[model samples]
Target: MNNGWFYTAEFRDGRFTQIQWQRSGQPPQTTTLTFSSTNGQGQPIYTGAFQAATAVTLVDLSGGNVQPGSQVSVEVEEWGWARGNCRR
Candidate 1:
């Protein structure tokens, strides 16, 4: 329960865009959160989705590295993607 890094989200077009994270020493980071409603004087402001998520920790990379607990798995998918919407 020490090693870290484990991000995974792969929803395209309408959302998620892309998110990836791997950890062994760190050097695998990606950010791509897509979804827009416009609001800074543009108008319309509510049309993003993704309403559920749980905890995760599974890992296995072997040759490339990263090997945490063999394989438990529970990261349904996430890079936050603004996580369930909340902007003010």
Candidate 2:
């Protein structure tokens, strides 16, 4: 069983790259973490929601089509676990 107290995740071009976390009461840390390397490709529908996510596919919202440097940043608010995307 793999486990860690993860607080944040980072990605580059749709690839799972790193995580910010802490091990119990220890100091929080930012460390390299990758649970997948397939670029999150494959079937879209996942039958299991409670199960850990095996993949994530990032897309380009640039209208033309998904291409290099086309990914955009999305701001999410977890305050009270209920909020919408906050764009500036």
State which candidate has the highest lDDT. 1
What local lDDT score does residue 22 receive in model 2, on the 0 to 100 scale?
A: 48
lDDT of 1 at 11: 40
Worst 10 residues of 1 by lDDT: 57-66
Give the lDDT of residue 30 in candidate 1.
54
TM-score for each of the candidates = 0.22, 0.30
The digit string of per-residue lDDT tens for model 2 on 1-88 reads 0243333444456343544444687677544443322224331111111113332222223332334454332211221111112122
**Candidate 2 residue pairs in clash (backbone atoms < 3 Å):** none
Instruction: Please report, in order, the local distance difference test score of every candidate based on alpha carbons.
Output: 0.35, 0.32
Off by over 4 Å in 2: 1-4, 34-88
- Which candidate number has the best TM-score? 2
